[model samples]
Target: SFRRSNVSPRFLHSNSTSHTWPFGAIAMLIDNAYDPDVSAKQFWIDKTVVKDQDCLTFMDNGYGLDLRTMHKMLSFGFSDKTTVKGVQPIGIYGNGFKSGSMRLGKDAIVFSKSKSTSCVGMLSQTYLEKIGAEQIIVPIVCFDQTKSDKHILDLMQ
Candidate 1:
């Protein structure tokens, strides 16, 4: 279910931490999609007809996360916005991506495409549990040509 990639980061979990909330995951999706560069576009939430799929999707025409930004998103306490001297962005603490995604499902599939490139990344709590790891591993892949088939999409770029 994950693409072959050389880059994967593991975030350690501690026994004393309680890191999930019922609404925080959904909130993260909305908050990240806010403030698009383009105007006259709206965000949406909908259910898909795919069988056995109970997940809800939040989508918008907002600027999507690039590979670099996506990597930072999965990392604990890593926010590029914090480095900007005069810029004040909301929730610069950077715990939202990991905690929120983990809370939402046993795994998360993040897909984002920029003008020249498209990327896919997956974070699986089940894999972490099976390995008895305190860390979360995110597998990422980037490509120029898009594949129509899901299985072929897992091939290395």
Candidate 2:
């Protein structure tokens, strides 16, 4: 069984306001990738035009997140990270992804691929508002290469 709670979409913008400086928000995201659990040695940030809209992309060769982890990342107030190999993680509040991402834009799409799975998740204030949603909603899909589910395949494409 799954339990549900209601969080207004407007919270995204209000929460992001804590980031007075955009650079600080970007640093929070970079710290997440550099954290011990992800241990990313390389990270790339770029800006490109998509459908005539300027967009930013961040990529890292880190240990990618699974569905469960992705869910936790999108949710508020959940952090299970601990010290690893004498290295400490910088994101302790578990609010970085939301605050940082929403500070940069109204929408964000995350693509992560672990050793055996690929996942996609989206956090979008624009989407919520357009749909007249009262509560925040995040849609996530995971694809396991070993399985051949048509629905999953469609989502992957």
Candidate 3:
């Protein structure tokens, strides 16, 4: 037998409320990039217009997440961070991405490229609300970098 569990979209907003200030939410993302697993040497944040909507984009020169890792990151309460070379990871609870992204906007799309794989995932309150979704739904797509997939090329652009 199999069991199903659903998470409400409202939970995203509720979780984000833990951050008293917006800066705290942004700090969470920054800390994640600096964490041992990622060890990002550079991170960039920029404002851009996408599909007529203003958006903020974040990019990092870290070890990017694979498909499974990206899924876990978007889900609730799953963290695999470990201390490396005496540097302890700051995100231990695995709720930071949800709290931080939801605090900043109604939607977030993550595009990550590891050495062998590339993936895209979305956590979108706007999409959920628009579709009248009763439970949160995350869509993720993965691409093998070795293949010449048009989807991968499109994502890169």
Candidate 4:
């Protein structure tokens, strides 16, 4: 029903290349964490600096993500909240997830869990450049009650 447009790899790379880290990206992430629809309550931001590693972590007690939400979150220029009738969304372009993670580092792993589902996905700029991938395939596994507990534990490990 919809026709796909031709987008060159160079264009994709250049378009995403940001010389400076944008604070809006961070704000977008926090805004999404607090969005009413997300049902997030407790939120946390953690930063650590060690000898070999310096990292930041953001966590929230949201409803977590389903497949569709995760896909839209990562897609360039795609956002469902922008069309909402009454509410105003903080982000319009849906660049928050991608751009924010990129600003943090070259690699990020997103993990989400709900009553019925739990999934893990990784984004790595180095990997993308090496593979010349136009799109990111976030491998997802739907788990049963027994596996869900174990899977979440393993992911944490």
Compose the digit string of candidate 4's lDDT tens values, residues 10-65.
Answer: 44345445625556556667888866557478888888765576777788998787
TM-score of 3: 0.89
Clash-forming residue pairs, model 1: none
Whole-model lDDT, candidate 2?
0.88
lDDT of candidate 1 over 8-115, digit per residue (tens): 224333311244554766776665555222121567877664468566666677566656766776656786553234434555666766666656556667787766
Q: Give the 10-residue window scoring lowest on summed lDDT in candidate 2.
A: 148-157
lDDT of each: 0.58, 0.88, 0.87, 0.63
Model 1 TM-score, 2 decimals: 0.65
Worst 10 residues of 3 by lDDT: 148-157
TM-scores of all predicted structures: 0.65, 0.90, 0.89, 0.69
Better of 2 and 3 by TM-score: 2
RMSD of each: 7.2, 3.4, 3.6, 5.1
Model 1, position 28: C-alpha lDDT score? 63
After superposing candidate 1 on the true structure, give the runs of residues whose Cα lies further than 4 Å from its correct spot. 1-21, 35-41, 49-53, 82-88, 130-134, 145-157
Badly placed stretches (over 4 Å) of model 3 are 1-5, 149-157
Ranking by lDDT: 2, 3, 4, 1
Say which prediction, candidate 2 or candidate 4, comes out ahead on lDDT.
2
Clashing pairs in 3: none
